[model samples]
Target: MQIGFFAVGIGPSADPEIIALTARTAEQAGFHSLWAPEHVVLIDQYASRYPYSQDGKLPMSTKVDILDPFVALTFAAAHTKTIRLGTGICLVPERSPVVTAKEIASLDKLSGGRFDFGVGVGWLAEEFTAVGVPWERRAERTREYLKAMKLLWTEEEPQFTGEFCSFPKVRLYPKPVQKPHPPILFGGESTPALKRVAEVGDGWFGVNVTVEDAKAKIERIRSYAQAAGRDPGKFRFMVSPGLGLPVELDMIKRYRDAGVHQVALGAIPRDAKGIKGEIERLAEKLVVPAAKL
Candidate 1:
């Protein structure tokens, strides 16, 4: 099992220097990855429910100071050599695929092939509207955007023609360091999302599901993969622990047994000493002996 940390990167609580230090230290401490969440801006009166929480509320802290994920990851990548840099979930439909693909590919090139592109179709209606995207067609748009991105990543003189996007053949420079592009981990729990992951993505990045349910979800995802003519074994399973603080090693082990390849604990407090202590604590309790146990 690969143990990792996920930070929201709230500006006041998380400084760039501290974020970089945390990434470096996580690498030194034998952690597998460091993930961050995205929110370009937050509107208090969102007309959508936050999927993970019972209340449809965005955390006030997150809304107040969320930093841009790509820039933060770029900063963290500079300070760490081995730890993989990831987005817990970048909402893709909000931005143009061509530009987003270029940025992500650039990051992969700059990071020496250590970028994991975890993505989602976002739940907040206000957010999609704010970005000038149609909320009703988010799922379809997400699918098309990902399909378009795949073309951008793998093709030479890539061209895409679709309902939402169209472009003539154009070459994307500084092709990703990772062959065939960086690993794409799609985030969502719905059937449509799972099907999308099975058909196009390299992995499933799920949120808010417990291990017991995750086991069932993985089985369903495998079924979808099979139906999509994909080999299920090639797809990775990654989870972001929402609302929960640090989880127990035994619980981590249980999730592994249930088919989780990577586990990331989110919303960690960002004080340096406190963050270091938390990292060491998780390493001692979960990661260091995770495989042996």
Candidate 2:
């Protein structure tokens, strides 16, 4: 299985120099990809319950500097040759499909086709409200948005007419280098999320899941794929075991056995002062060893 680093490119590590160094270090260390999360804006208070945490709270402070994932990945792309850059989970429903499609295609083209579009229908109701997207039908909207983006990416003169998105036949330039566009990896662990993956996603991105849970979830996703008449083997599964989990050989093997195509480990440095050392140690201790096996 491939190993990747789930980078929190925001907060103290948001410096351009640090981002460049991390990407170069990860690429040289044999990591398959460098994934970053997205949060366009954060509210001071919210009623939304974060699903990954035990107490349903966001892990980071609200004041943290969350960078735009695509822009950050674009910078990383300019600094590295091989390591793939991905948005660990881009909130699709909150953004315009047309502009987002252009950004995705532009990033893919400029990065030599090294972009993975991991997306979700977001959980923060207040944020969604702030962005002017109704929370009630966000999932349906997200699905339609993905469809709309695909049309723009594949067709020479693309047009889309859906409940949430509609546009006349118009030409979009700089089509993505990756055939049929970059891989669309959907993130979430709920049943609807799994069904969405089977229906539209190129892969499944499971977050905060254990080995045993991953096994079951993969099986369910495969079953859903079969139900939808899609080959289960064509889909990929990636998991990012919640932050602070031990990254060891046995755990890596367990994830591989559970059908994970890639495992993304949280590489949050203790602080900006120790970023380089942390990257080297994570590579030497976990990423490099895991890649060899």
Candidate 3:
């Protein structure tokens, strides 16, 4: 099992010096990847349900400092040599597909093809409303956007005409260094989310699930993949055992045994000093054991 981290590039890690230190720390510590979450805007209060929290509220307040995932990852890419980087979940429907594609391709090219695109048709309806995106048919919008982006990355002379996105033939230069494109890891645990991954995702970024839940979800996703005529063997399964899970060797082993390619620990303390300390500790306690697994 590859040990990675979720909730990177938030709070103090948004600072340039701190991001350099944190990114290099993870790379040197043998972590597999550093994944950052995205929320373009946050309101003090919103009615949208936060699926991970019991009270249907976000863990963060509007004052929390969160960097744009692409910018944050690009900064980390410049600061590190080998540790992989990902958008733990970029809100796909909230951004333009053509612009988003350029950002992903640019990041991949700049990062030497080390980027993973973990995306979601976001849940916060209020945020969507704030961004002027319709709250309805978001899943369909995400699917169409991804199709358009894929064409941009893979085709030399690309053109896409879809219900949500359309563009004329154009030369998209600096194509992603990754062949075709970087891995598209769909995020979420909903049935539609799993089915969406089966249809288009290169992987699944399951959030806030335990080892047992991870196992069952992976199996279910595989079934969905088979039903969709996709090869489950080609898909990567990445899980984030929530903050409450024990980050012990035995726990890591159980996740590995569950066929998880990578297991991500939840966000650490938000301060730069705290972030650095926690990652170093997790490196010793989790990365070493996971590598042996």
TM-score of each: 0.95, 0.97, 0.97
lDDT of each: 0.82, 0.89, 0.87
Which lDDT tens digits does candidate 2 get at residues 165-241?
99999999889999988999999999999999999999999998999999999999999999999999999999998
Give per-residue lDDT, candidate 1, residue 200. 84
Ranking by TM-score: 2, 3, 1
Better of 1 and 2 by TM-score: 2
| Residue 269 in model 1: lDDT | 63
Ranking 1 against 3 by lDDT, winner:
3
**Where does candidate 2 have its weakest 10-residue lDDT segment?**
266-275
| Candidate 3, number of clashes | 0
**RMSD of each candidate relative to the true structure:** 1.5, 1.1, 1.2
Best by lDDT: 2
lDDT tens readout by residue for model 3, 1-293: 79887766777667787778778888898988988889998887777888988888887667878899999999999999898999989999999999999999999988889998999999889899999999999999999999999999999999989998899998887899998799999988989998899899999998888888889888988999999898999999998877646678888788878878998884645677877888888888889877987
Better of 1 and 3 by TM-score: 3
Candidate 2 residue pairs in clash (backbone atoms < 3 Å): none
What is the Å distance of residue 70 in model 3 from its true position? 0.5
Between candidates 1 and 2, the lDDT winner: 2
Ranking, lDDT, top scorer first: 2, 3, 1
